[model samples]
Target: MLLEALTHTWPWYIAGPLIGLFVPLLQLVGDKQLGISGNLRHLCSALLPRRIDFLRYDWRGAGAWNLIFALGTLLGGWIGVHLLGTGEIAISPDTQASLHALGVHDLSGLVPHEIISWEGLLTVRGFVSVVAGGFLVGFGTAYAGGCTSGHAISGLSNFQLRSLFAVLGFFAGGLLATHLLLPLLF
Candidate 1:
């Protein structure tokens, strides 16, 4: 079941690659792909941004399918946590030991909890970070002519070497941010 998969086996490394696989399959079937970064354009359209791009696409021409999909995602996530079970992934000792090397131990902020609840996964600080990060990601995706998923999934599937490079950059940027920058900021 989806709930079991989420609760028992979901991790970024696992989900990311599986999703990277799924996106291309969807693209092959629908001729369209998925990415979270583009949602900023939706938010921008909702806010009447200086650049009204999401509106120009006429997503409504899809008969509000986008809206339905949005609702489904939200509903599905809630069901996963509430109906199936709550998530509390235990961080690996390797991660904690690495944090130890970074002068972070069990200390607050400097060190993170080993086990994280779904809500704890989205603390106020985390939420703010998501908002700011989302904004930056939106800008980057727009500038890149496609988001990470588009590049890693749709573009890469066609053997576009550029997508491979972009994916590498994405991984590099994430490592730099999480390992180096985030600790400094927090």
Candidate 2:
């Protein structure tokens, strides 16, 4: 039963609450912020010379737990994939039809290889979808002061108004991307 549960996706009702509860548990344990975007800054600060103002910080004191958390997340993903394995993503038939119409036939993996593979990267559609999309996400994360997980989970749990606005913006951006931008790209 435990193996079955570990290998399959949990329903939102089960997964959502677990993720929601993680915020307080994280705070209760160490008062650490729940975010992944800051890990890049922490890593750069640790590796790079302390000449740049942004990279010059006590990253060990501020983000050691975050780094450890990131490492644990990576390890967990490896274990889940290599040892436990994963069930196929259950995309709805209607959604699959829509994607098929957009020229994405293969729904075998976590993402569509048509849009994410090396050959795809060299094409205009792939370059715009992957490279440009990644740049926008990174820029938006930096601008919003946190990623969706941080703002939606940790920041909102803490009753931060900024996080509320950030989450709203994130949703709006996602909607725009899905409806308007995705069709154009695909």
Cα lDDT listed for each candidate: 0.63, 0.85
RMSD of each: 5.4, 2.0
TM-score of 1: 0.65
Which whole-number lDDT from 0 to 100 does residue 163 have in model 2?
A: 96
In candidate 1, stretches whose alpha carbon ends up further than 4 angstroms from where it belongs are: 1-7, 10-21, 24-29, 49-55, 62-64, 100-128
Highest lDDT scorer: 2
**Poorest 10 consecutive residues of model 1 by lDDT?**
108-117
Candidate 1 per-residue C-alpha lDDT over 12-119 given as tens digits, one digit per residue, 9 for 90 to 100:
798778877766665676755665545555555555655555445644544244455556788987876677665444667787777677644453432244313345
lDDT of 2: 0.85
lDDT of 2 by residue, 36-149 (tens): 888777887899846988789899998999999999999988997788786789989999998888888889877778788888898887888889988898778867879967
lDDT for 142 in candidate 1 is 69
Give the CA lDDT, 0 to 100, for residue 26 in model 2. 83
